[model samples]
Target: MTHPMALPVVRTLNTDRHRVALQVFMVVVVAHWAEHLAQAVQIYVLGMPTSEARGVLGLPFPWLVHSEWMHYGYALVMMVGLILLRPGFVGKARTWWTAALLIQVWHHFEHLLLLLQALVGTNIASRPVPTSLLQLALPRVELHLFYNAIVFIPMVVAMIKHGKPSDEELAAAPCRCAPAKV
Candidate 1:
């Protein structure tokens, strides 16, 4: 059974508002990607100090860079967006979108671990600041960049497939995302 609140939201998002919902979701994902890219460029290309390498928004809100809650919030939002819009996808688009969603589930778990570590004032295995499981092998910045890329790549592919769906797919799809059928 669906939660009372989830019923209408899932219906509207998957139906009448699907196209706009997808556009909004894509903007959020791309913005997050851009922020990560900006941070990487600041550190690797511009030789900015690591502490000072807050991305565009973080420049204005430096504490955001250090706040595990902020990171966790973004991860949660990404996961929710993926889940909410998932039903709008069908066939090949659904497969690729599911791939992105599954990867994001792991990414969200990592962020949750970091947030828990921060809240408890203990690193996961007791070293320094909060560290994710993957951070064991890769640095935090690189890990996040890697996570974002994998999720974004599959999501983009899904969007491309969604936009050029087959004739049957177009007929069954809820929103007008693809070109008009001749």
Candidate 2:
């Protein structure tokens, strides 16, 4: 028998509500990716200075790149979103979603470490600013772009698989990501 407290949690994660929530979360994720991509284009394509290459929203909030809190918050959200929506995925979609979740977990850890260092008034490898572990090899902006790309690829794959699930997968899904039966 399910515990009373667990019942709501199960229902939240196992209903059509979860699918809608996942779709909304993915829109936010894509927006973030666009920001990163825009930033990259500003630097590499437009020849803008790194400091001046703030993307769309960054034009007004140029300090976003310097804010550990913002980075950590995004990482945390991605992790939580992936975990919360995972129960609704099944079969191939589940596998791809798990892949994205695993990568995001690692990405979250990197941001966590960076945030901790910033909070402690220290920096990775004694750099002047907060730095992720991978930042030692790649600059922070580029590293984040790489991280987002890797995570997003699998996420997109999962969404595709979810939308056109196999018959068995459709049967297992608690939500209607698959097309309705005629």
> Which parts of model 1 are misplaced by more than 4 Å?
2-6
Task: State which candidate has the highest TM-score.
Answer: 1
Candidate 2 error regions (>4 Å): 1-10
What tens digits encode model 2's per-residue C-alpha lDDT throughout 1-182?
85422567756765757667877998999899999999999999999998899888889887887788998999999998888788788898889999999999999999999999989998877898878888888987889899998999999999999889888888888887678766
Q: Clashes in each model (backbone N, CA, C under 3 Å)?
A: 0, 0
Candidate 2: 10-residue stretch with minimal lDDT: 2-11
> Which RMSD does model 1 reach against the true structure?
1.8
State every prediction's TM-score relative to the real structure: 0.94, 0.92
TM-score of 2: 0.92
Q: How many backbone clashes does candidate 1 have?
A: 0
Angstrom error of the Cα, residue 132, model 2: value is: 1.0
Worst 10 contiguous positions by lDDT, candidate 1: 2-11
